[model samples]
Target: MRAPHTATTLGSAAPARDGPAQQVARFGRHVAEMCAVMCVTLILTGLAVTAAAAALGTSNPITGAPAATAAVATLALAASMTAWMRYRAMDWRPTLEMAGSTIAAGAVMLTGYAAGVVPADALVGGTCGLACVAMVAVMLFRFRLYASHAHHAPSGH
Candidate 1:
């Protein structure tokens, strides 16, 4: 014979679902984390671009090609973000997705510029802005991965 079904209490061993407010707060925190990541990425890209410009002769990062400059900046952003994610031991899938999105953003701007669609002057702002939005979108899509700090520490103890 089967045992009778019983109603479980709220404080039972089973994990409780977060309330609506708690869910909102968690989402807010996740957004904030992505913002912080974007900020760090921008700072790293800035330093790299400054050095590149200096090395290339105070003309521009790539000289006579704003699209190329934007590409270099985006590459720097992706590289820094990848290194940071690897250091945090985050899953490779999302990390690569984030980085790939950044690259894709730059490529789009480059294509537009090549097609005479995007103004050369707007390449930097357009590429960087789109890349930042893409990164945040990736984080939002994989909230569980981005929201938790469990894998933040390096793998080795």
Candidate 2:
């Protein structure tokens, strides 16, 4: 007698994995996390600029020039984001990777400013804008790190 068919259907069957909906949900969660981290970084960078302006008693140019402001803001952005990530108990590698990428982007812009290639208005736009873009680029390059559910988990949970 012929054997009845079963759900197993063993030969050449595809391995079960997350459905499309589940994949989209996970990606959405990661995007939210990135947004939260970046928002915090930008807010902190603004506070840093405000504090510098207040201390200097002038807003014409923070730290005496646009280039200086760019450098300061870029560092602040990197530091703020790194601090927040570490607070969340994220892995050190990615944290440092992000910080390094931000600093590098700022350095490029600063160089451009020095060379007179970057306009003063662009610097005023905030160096963190470029640094933030770099951070997102790094995230995309390291997709596996950001895509995995474990990376998004809250610490001590």
Candidate 3:
């Protein structure tokens, strides 16, 4: 007679290992953490700008703009980081596209600052933008490093 099955079956088994699903869940958690950190960073930056503006006088339009711009930039930066993390975990092509776009935008922004079009109080906003661009660059480099290491592994497994 056939023996009864004692081990877990297909539907009853746990995940084979931390595969794509675990990677995705990890990415989601990372995104949430990044967002929270960005929120605090932006808020502090805005408050600093506002205080500096008040000291410099409300007549300064640049000071006021930075507070608002910083908030938006921070949120965008968080989103970009999340995308980069996800891409790093699975793919590189789309990440390249995003990194290219981000770098181009960052260049344009830095140009504006170099032209003296940006106000002194809004310098913080420019700094935040640059940081976001840098984050993308770091992510790209990290993926490249890991990919090379993975390819050279002795066995596919």
Pick the TM-score winner. Answer: 1
Q: With candidate 2 superimposed using the best TM-score fit, by how many Å does residue 51's alpha carbon deviate from the native?
A: 4.0
Clashing pairs in 1: none
Residues 1-157 of candidate 2 have per-residue lDDT tens digits of: 2232223335747544555676557656765676677677667776777777779786656445778777777777678777877765567777888889888988998888889898877874556677767877887787655654454333332
Clashing pairs in 2: none
Candidates ranked, most accurate by lDDT first:
1, 2, 3
The model with the greater lDDT, 1 or 3, is 1
Candidate 3, residues 1-157, lDDT tens digits: the string is: 2232234548876533444665455545543544455556567655665566678776443555643454445445545554644533524444444445444554556566668886656555565656655654554455433323121212212
lDDT of 3 at 156: 14
Please give the lDDT score at residue 103 for candidate 2. 88
TM-score, per-candidate, Cα-based? 0.72, 0.71, 0.40
10-106 per-residue lDDT for model 1 (tens digits): 7797544555676567667766665677677677776777786788777555436686678777887788777877765665776789899899999
What residue runs in model 2 are displaced by over 4 Å at the alpha carbon? 1-16, 19-21, 62-64, 124-126, 152-157
Q: Compared to the true structure, candidate 3 yields what TM-score?
A: 0.40
- Give me the candidate number with maximum lDDT: 1
